[model samples]
Each structure stands twice: as structure tokens, then as C-alpha cells.
Target: MIALQIIARLLDYPDEALWAHRDDLLSALADSQALDEENAAKLSAFIKPFCAAELLDRQAEYCSLFDRGRATSLLLFEHVHGESRDRGQAMVDLLDQYRAAGLVLDSKELPDYLPLYLEYLASLPLEEARSGLVDIAPILALLAARIAQRDSHYAVLFELLLAISGVALNSADVAEKLQQESRDDTPQALDAVWEEEQIKFLSEQGCASAEETAHSQRFAGAVAPQYINLDAHFESGTAGESRP
Candidate 1:
């Protein structure tokens, strides 16, 4: 699960501290016997360019890809509900889930942020973490495809996440999800997407709701914060160290 923790950090907003420890993070992934050989290689390949790039360039790209557009937004519910009231409710529910597991969000991050979710997963027992990862596989797949369409290397992170989940990647389903939304990253396109009205929840329709049941079952057990090494490293300062 340290590998998950490392990947989560890599996916977070770039900073000098993260760049300083880039080698350490890569070393952890490369040395991890837990990661499949292919994924380990893919991960290294994915990160190597970022490590070699100018820090500001890397930060700019991260901001462009993740910060700008809903198509590649890292907030989970944005893909699910856009800017609707349901997203607000889902955020509250997800925050409650985190609190139930004794995690307090001291930072300004919303509960559905993917890196925060990964950090939460890293805190869980391996089986529970894997189960939670599997539960979010669809969202991961959707994001992976979106990034890949832009030819961004960050897609590899999502690929590694989906691989770790041990769920079969459904290309057709991912493609379908992609097709349902506009891929243009323009402000107008984003406004158009957000303009769509919110759909009612499954419970509101009085339908049999497996998703509701799964949500309840997913966070049933609470584990204390045990991934101290990485957590401490993250909290020590900004994300990366300046290059000599």
C-alpha cells in the first residue's frame, strides 16, 4: 500500500518538495514487488519525463490537465453529477464516510478529490483498500481514457490504479462514458456541460439500488492513520525539493 501512497502523491499538485523526492518515489515504485512488472515499467516511463522536465513546466501541465477542465477533472463527483445539487450531497456523504473512518479533512481539499481518496485507501487494510479501489474502477477508467485522449502521460497513473484494482478494464464501457460527454476543454464547452440539469438519485426513483447498498458496505470498518511515513513526508513541507 506504500506504492498506492506514493502514486497518490505523484498525482497531487506539483511542488518543489515532490520533485526533490522524485527519485525516492520512483525508487519505491521500481522496487515494489507488489506492482506487476508491466505496470512498474509503465509507471517509471510515465514519471521519468516529469522528473526530467523543468519544475515549472511540469506544474503548468498538471494545472492545464487537471485544473482547467471538467473532462479531466480529478474530483470524482464532477464526472458523476457535474455542478448539480447531487454533487453537493454526494460530497457531504463522502465526507461523512471519511469522518466515520476517523479521518478529518484538515486541508481545504474536498472529499472526492482523487488524491485524497487514494490517501484514504492507503490508510486502509490492503483488502479493504483493494475493494475500495475496485469500487471506483469505473471512474478511474473514465479519467484514464480522457487523459489518454489528450495524450497525457498522467493516464498511466490511472492505468496503474485500475490494474491494481484487479478489475477487468472495460474499453467499450469507458468509450461509452466518454461519448456521453463533450471532450472539448474550452470554457464554453464546460459551461454547456454544467448547464445540464441534475438527474434524480436512484433512491428518489424508488428503484432497487445496489449502488446505495455498496456505498454503505464499502466504509464499514474504520482504520486509524497508520501510513505515517508517507503522511509525514507529505506534511513536512511543500511537495518537492528544489533541484541542485
Candidate 2:
């Protein structure tokens, strides 16, 4: 009953009175010895997706905060007294709470951005997906800026991350298990080929290291240097002198 109340409260969201009541709800659950591990796990899974979806809905309401996509939900908070304002904040608070508890944010689907970012994410290989998690901070930074500017990017990014969360979590589990098993499981021939190709493509495109690749471009090398050393002096002319 206590855990159920937490779920209910989380769904309720940003209600000042309700937010104030969450601790009591959580404490009630924590104090209750009747709650079983199976029930607790079920409760955790249920809240996980609900919080994720809730964030996605909020991001949809603030589509302008995003780089792509138009706002689909008309029922958005005007930052005035309304359900939208409360609902949005409630989701954010819920996510923060979960993170505080050590749950990871989703890294795949951008709910508002949806199917499109999903497709882009799907195109990348397992390694890319793993690395993408690290690069997510920059994307989040962009979304944060949008949110600051009253744009809807956070909603989009949140949704995307939620979608990616399941995949990331599953991947992590598999990786961990494989490591424990000493990778006794063998990959299919085609899977091996595909994985190899993905690594090569990402490496060549400079996407493997997002920070480095982002700065370098694959140019045609058509334009030459504007100025050349006429003297072609191979030695360092000025060792300790400063030139203005």
C-alpha cells in the first residue's frame, strides 16, 4: 500500500501539496516490512517507465526548446497557474529523485523527437551506442540552453534518453554478464561482420570520438595554404625572442 502510494504520488506530480506529501509516502513504504522484494522490483520497474514517459510528455509540450520538431501538445504550461506547469515540474522532480537513487537516464529514444532519433540511434553499432551515452551531456547541454530560453529541447532530449534507457541498461547487463562469463558466447558470422563494419564507419567518419571528430572535417583538400614561407628557412630563427 505504501509503495502503491508512491507510484500514485509520482503520477500526480508537481502538486505543491502532493510534492510535500511524497516523503511521507516514501517513508511509509520504507518502514513497512510487509513489502516483498518481488513487489519492490515490480514497483521500481513501473515507476521507471512512468517517470520516463511523463518526462517525454513534458518535453513534447516544450518543443521549441528542441532543435527539431514542432510542438504537438497544445496543453502546455504558460508558466502560469495551471496543470501543465505542475505536471512538467513533477516529472522533472521524479527523474531527479530516481537519479539521486542511482538510476540512469535513458539514452536512446527522444520521445518528442521519437522515431527519427530512434532511427539515427539504431543505425549506430553497439560501441557507438555505448559511446553515445558519454556524448549525451553535450546534447543535454543544448537542451538545457533551449529550456533556459523557454524552448522545448529538454522535453525532446528527455524523451530520447528515456527511449534509449532500456537499450542502454540491457546492453550494460549483457556486457557485464559477458565479462563475468569471459565472453564464452560466440557471435554469428553476420553479427561479427556488422559490428566490424560499424566500428570502421564510425572510425572513418570520426564519430568514434565525438569530441575530436566534431572538430575535424573530411574536406576535399581543394584549397591550398594562402601564404608560403618564401625563404624556406628550415631552422628555428627565433629561439627565445617574442615577436609582436
Candidate 3:
């Protein structure tokens, strides 16, 4: 449970507050009983360098990984809903669940934000948290595989979550999936997406338009400053910027 909270903090955008709490976070990570020996080693390798790096470097890395495209997006419902109208109602239902669990989101983060969900899970009973992780294990696995492909340390967080949820990632399956996957976050792909949208507006409504707009990111709001850390619950400070 504590590890869930720790993962939530580390998974959020790295900011000054996170840097200030680096020692504490690492200490707490070491204290967690949930992590096995291999997981402990993996986290140490990930966390130490992450904390040792320059603050700006960390933030820039975060933006590059998450902000460019939707493939490795942290917004859980994006994977599930994919711009369908049901996504809206799903957010409503999730927010209601948050309130029912005696938690409130005063920030702009919509429900299903992964870190926020992990924090909520950390607040729950052991079995309850495990069940929550189990429900979304597939999503976590998707993210883990993608991050692992990038050889980024961030993959360890999702791997830990999967292990806690009693799920094992299949490396061969992940390899095949990655082989078939296009790099959506690349510069050319991003330009093409915008160009396609422009053409859709200039053209009539038809199959071309539908296919072009299929990957539209209509709900992603402006990237703003928000604290997704223990700060507001501790003190006030900026955390990281994740385009939810």
C-alpha cells in the first residue's frame, strides 16, 4: 500500500517538491514490504539516477515521454474509451467513486489519471487495492511494455504495479506488440496528425474525415501547473506536468 503511494509520487511529473522529498521518497520506498528483492533492485536502479539528475533534466524527460502522443498516455480511460462519448460518463462515475471513498479532487485532474488512481488505491484496504490494480493490470502492462521499449527507468513503476496485482508481463508478447506498433510520438507522425486534421476540416464529412479524426485528442486540456504529489496533503508545491 505504501509502495502504491510511493509509485504515485514518482510517477507524477517531477518538480521541486518531488526533488525536496527525494530522500524521504527513497526512504519510504526502501521501507515498503511489498517489493521483492528483484523489484527492490530495479527500483533502486531507477530511483537513484532519477533523483541524482538535474531537476530540469527530469522535467524535460517527463514531458518528452508523456506529452508528445497518446501511446504511453497515463490517462487510463484514454486506452479504454478512445474519444467515444462513454468516456465522459465514465469519468463521472469514477469521480463519484472517489467521493464515495471520501477523497476529493480539487485539482483539474480528471478521474482515471493513473497516479491519482494509485493514490486512491493506497487509501483503500489491501485486498481492495489489489483488486483495483488487477482490474487495470492490462493497461499497466501496456504502459510497462512501451516504456521498456524506450529503455527508460519509468517502466519499473508499471512493472512493480503489475507484480503487485499478481500479473506477469510476457516479454515475447510485448516484443511482438512493439514490433507492430508505430511511433505515434515521433515528429513526423505528430506533423502528419495535424495535417490530417487540417485536411479533414477542408474536406467533406466522409470516411476519410472519420479515419483522420479517429486519433484526435479533443479532451486533453492545456498543460498547466498542478501538484499531484503529497504536497497539498503535506504542504503546497508544484509536482510534475502530465497531460491527462
Candidate that scores best on lDDT: 3
**lDDT of every model, 2 decimals:** 0.70, 0.35, 0.74
Task: List TM-score per model, in order.
Answer: 0.72, 0.20, 0.80
| Superposition-based RMSD of candidate 2 using all C-alpha atoms, in angstroms | 23.7
Tens digits of lDDT, candidate 1, 116-148: 999898888887777778666666777777788
* 93: Cα error in model 2, Å: 38
Compared with the true structure, model 1 gives a TM-score of 0.72
Clashing pairs for model 1 are 16-240, 16-241, 17-239, 17-240, 17-241, 18-239, 18-240, 19-240, 20-241
Instruction: Give the best candidate by TM-score.
Output: 3
RMSD of 1: 14.9
98-123 per-residue lDDT for model 3 (tens digits): 99999979878778889999999999
Q: lDDT value for candidate 3?
A: 0.74
Q: Is candidate 1 or candidate 2 better by lDDT?
A: 1
Q: CA lDDT of 101 in candidate 1?
A: 80
